[model samples]
Structures are given as C-alpha cells and as structure tokens.
Target: MNTSHQSFAYTLHDVTCLFRKHFDRRAIRYALTRAQWRALKAIRRREGMSQTELAEFLEMEAIAVGRVIDRLAAAGFVERRADPNDRRCWRLHLTSRAHAVTDDMEVLASELRREALAGVSTADFEAFERVLGKIRSNLSAIESGTEAGAEFTSS
Candidate 1:
C-alpha cells in the first residue's frame, strides 16, 4: 500500500548489492576473500585485538573468524601471537603486506564512493546521510526495547 516504502527498500537493496559488486571487482586483484579483507581491515583498525574480540566486532562466529585469521597468517598478511596476559587468546597484528592491502582497499572504496555520488549535490547527500543515521538510531533503540520512533513515520 505504501509506494514510498517499497521504493526505499528497493533502492537500498540495489545500491548495497551494486556496491558489493563494485568492491569485489576492485578487490579481486588482491587475492583475498571478502571475509579476509574485512578481517584485515578490522585488525588494522584495532591492532593487537584478540581473535575473539575481532569476531565480536565483525559479528561473526569465533571459529569462523579463527579460520580467516589462520588463512591470513598462512598468507603472511597477518601474524598471531599468544597474548601475554591470556595464553589461550591469540592477538592479531597485520603484517606490512596486509597494511598495504588495507590501504589500497580504502583507496578503492573512495573511488567507488566518488562514482556513486557523481551527480549528487553535497546538501542532498548530507540530508540523505542524516536520514539514514536517524533510521539507524531508531532501529538501535527498538532493538534495545526502548521507545519506538514515531516522529519520522507518515501521519
């Protein structure tokens, strides 16, 4: 019954899929799976994080993230060492090679963003981002069983 909601859903899904395809095209050259790349980015952002912490940040299972870290270590893109304070935990660190790849991934993401916003005006984009942020906050509140948002809904 609501054409506007349908349109919003379609555009959001389409844009997300398109962005993934674009990023994959650019990222394939680095020979890293998307999971590996994401793990690398997270590790780079929070160097020396234990694998369990990284999994929580990534919202992935610890075992799955452990496998990714294993591959990354085997490829020499990352090194995992026993935590000084916690022997059972393996702290992750990106090698120089992984650092370079993550840096390039940022450049690629910037280029993709530039292309996606080629004709959008700054004001319009800022408004769009503000709306998205508001929606995100609203959903976060809902998830936490707090007050549901009524202000943004149609009358």
Candidate 2:
C-alpha cells in the first residue's frame, strides 16, 4: 500500500479521537457523560426499541446499557414500558423531560459540528459524507460475508 493509503487509516482514527475529546470537554457543562449522551441519542433514534436492540445498536453490552437506562430513568429522562408482544422484555421510551433535553443537546451538537467544519466548503463536506457512507457500507458487507474479504484469518 502507498503511504497515503496507510495515512488514511491513521487520519480517520485521529479525527475520531479528537472529535470525541472535544465533545467530552463540552458535554461536562450539560452534566452528562459521553456514554449517557450516546445512549440518549441512540434511544432518541429508535424510541420504542428494547434494551437488547439498543445494546446492539450502541455496540455495548446489554448490562452496561441497562445501567445507562437506569441512570436516565432516575433522572426523569427515560422510561420503560412492558412489551405487549414479549412479557420478558421492556420497550424503552424517552420522557417529556428527555425530549427537551434532546433538543438542547441537538443545538449543542450543531454548534460543535459547525465549529469543526468551519473552513470546509459545502461541496467538500458532502463529498466527505459520501465517502464515509461508502466506507461504512463496504465494511458492513465484509462483516456480513457478502464481500470476498469476509474470510479474515489471524496469522
């Protein structure tokens, strides 16, 4: 692989780490941890999803997500309702309180994104997004065994 290709992976990792660091610094003012913010955002995306589904979506352990839900519930930000289709499962829902909080969080996130992309032109930003989407799709295909590179073996 060329040097530029090798640098691409490092650049992506560094960008992600730096973004998280900045977000974490800003998140303290909202009295929420990065994990809590992540959980909240995932829940907001799929309001009626079960804990198992959430754990999968967040790529976290179910127990860890349960703990996050517990904290959110204690803070009046989330609620769990019995699943009508499955007695053993609970459907998670955001409270009215969480809705208001989510709105404020959205504004904060927008500000951070704007600051991060200050010098980028709209065309460049759109192209970057498309490239990211393609990368994700390619990776997903490999993981699902649909792509030829799925058979990864440890040396």
Candidate 3:
C-alpha cells in the first residue's frame, strides 16, 4: 500500500480507539458494560426485535444475546415479552428506565460528533463521507460473496 493509504488506515484505527475510549469514559456512570450498552441501544432502535434477529444484527450468538437480555431485564433497563406469533421467540423492548439513559447517550454522541468535527469543513466532510461509503460498499460486496459476479453464496 502507498504511504497515503497507510496513513489513512492509521488514522481510522486511532480515531476509532479514541472514540471508544471517550465514550467508555463518559458512560461509566450508567454502570452498564459496553456490550450491555450496545445491546440496549440496538433494542431501543428496533423495539420488538426477536432475540434471534438482534443476535444477528449484533453479530453475536443467540445464546449470548439471550444472556445480555437477561441481565438488562434484571437491571430494569429492558424487558423481553413472548412473541405473539412465534412461541419459540421473545420480542425485546426498552423499559422506561432506559429511556433517560439512552437519551443521555444520544446527547453524548452529538457532543462527541461536534468535538470531532470542530474544524472540518462541510464540503470536506461530505467528500470524506462519500469515500467512506464507497469503501464500505466494496467491503460489503466482498463480505457478501457477491463481488464482480463471482457466483458465490454463503449463509
């Protein structure tokens, strides 16, 4: 790879690490583990998602997601109700207690965005986003086994 590509890779890794550290620092008061916050946010985003679907979305095993759900339910941050149509599955929902914490998380995210983009110009940011989208599309195509009509399939 060229120097420029190496620099970009380094920047991405550093920025991602910094952002995670920053968020983890700010989120300590909630007493939720990183995985718990991720699960909560995912459930909050897609209320009523089955545990299996949430597991898939989180790229975790269904058993692992179930354990997270159990912990969250114990904390009163979320609840799992029996799926009306699927007796074998449970639908997850965020409890009222989680709403305020999730709201704070959103505020923290917005503040972090502002801090990160402090000096970045809108045009430059837009171009950066476009490039990122292209890269993401290429990676997704490769991951999905659909690159350049490769005639490959995977479950």
Candidate 4:
C-alpha cells in the first residue's frame, strides 16, 4: 500500500474537501452553510428541541449551535419559542421559510447521494454504510467519555 494513501487523516480531509465542494455547488442557494442545514433539518424533524438538545444531536458545542441558530433566526428561517415546561429554555421551530428550504434540501440531498453513489452496487453500499456506522459509533463513544481513544484503530 502507498504510505501516503494509508493516512487516515489525509483520507478524512479529502472527503471533507469533496463534500464542501459538492455542497457549494449544490446547496449554497439556500444561504445556509452545511452545519446550518443540518441544524434546520434536525429542528424540522424534532419540531421542538431545545438548543442544548440540538447541540447534543449535532455533536457540536452549544455555543457554536447557538450562533447558527442566531443566524437562522435572523434570516427568518427559525423561531425560538419559550418552552412551556421550562420558561428559561427555548424550543426550536422551523419557520415556513425554513420548511420550504427543507423541501429543497431533501431534493438536493437525494440528487447528491445519487451522484455520489453512481455505479456502486447495493451490497457494496450496505457494507460501506456499516463501516461508516462503526466509525461513527467508535468516535462518538470516545467523544462522550465512555471509552478511551485506544478503542479506535487509526486506519
């Protein structure tokens, strides 16, 4: 194997670059960054999540998530309503404008996925997905303090 190609960080960086390139080409029109798009999608699905929950779901720092929400709220894409159960906590809601953007995002995501998986077989795709799941689980476990980094193998 080529030594350079064996670096996991290099592979991860390349994938990130590719994703950013495609996202720019395909999803930049909604005036939301990829992180904002993810937060919006989560808000749409959960409908009344708090900023803390949203940050946990997104695996982002609460402050970072708050900034994204701030931008979205300013853009009229999301609204923060006082939680009935907890007046101090605000629940997130997608605005009608956000719903419209979510619809476009779904289509864009589907198209991007199709393009990304062009020519890949179903079995191969399934295996790839399983590998990705394991990677995510491993990283998440490490991140949440359940396990040490020793549990993960650097590929």
Model 2 bad stretches (over 4 Å): 148-155
Q: Taking the tens digit of each residue's C-alpha lDDT, what string does model 1 give over 67-89?
A: 99999999999999889998888
Task: Give lDDT tens digits, candidate 2, residues 1-155.
Answer: 34445577789999899888887787677687788898889889999999999999989999999999999999988899999999999999999988888888888789889999999999989988977777787788878977643332223
Q: What is the TM-score (0 to 1) of candidate 4?
A: 0.79
3 or 4, greater by lDDT: 4
Which rank order by TM-score, best down to worst? 1, 3, 2, 4
Could you report the Cα RMSD, in angstroms, for every candidate shown? 1.8, 4.8, 5.5, 3.7
CA lDDT, every model vs. true structure: 0.90, 0.85, 0.86, 0.87
Candidate 2 structure, TM-score to reference: 0.87
The segments of candidate 3 whose C-alpha lies over 4 angstroms from its true place after superposition are 148-155
Among residues 3 or more apart in sequence or in different chains, the pairs in candidate 4 whose N, CA or C atoms overlap within 3 Å are none
Residue pairs whose backbone atoms clash in candidate 1: none
**Highest lDDT: which candidate?**
1
| C-alpha positional error of residue 106 in candidate 1 after TM-score superposition, expressed in Å | 0.9
Q: Which ten residues in a row have the lowest lDDT in candidate 1?
A: 146-155
lDDT tens digits, residues 54-136, model 4? 99999999999999999999999999999998889999999999999999888887888788789999999998777767778
For candidate 3, lDDT tens digit of each residue in 42-128? 988999999889989999998998898899999999888998998987889998999889999999988988998999999989988
Better of 1 and 4 by TM-score: 1
Ranking by lDDT: 1, 4, 3, 2
CA error at residue 67 for candidate 4, angstroms: 2.5
Error (Å) of candidate 3 at residue 18 is 0.6
Q: Name the 10 consecutive residues with the lowest summed lDDT in model 2.
A: 146-155
The stretch of ten residues in a row with the least summed lDDT in candidate 3 is: 146-155
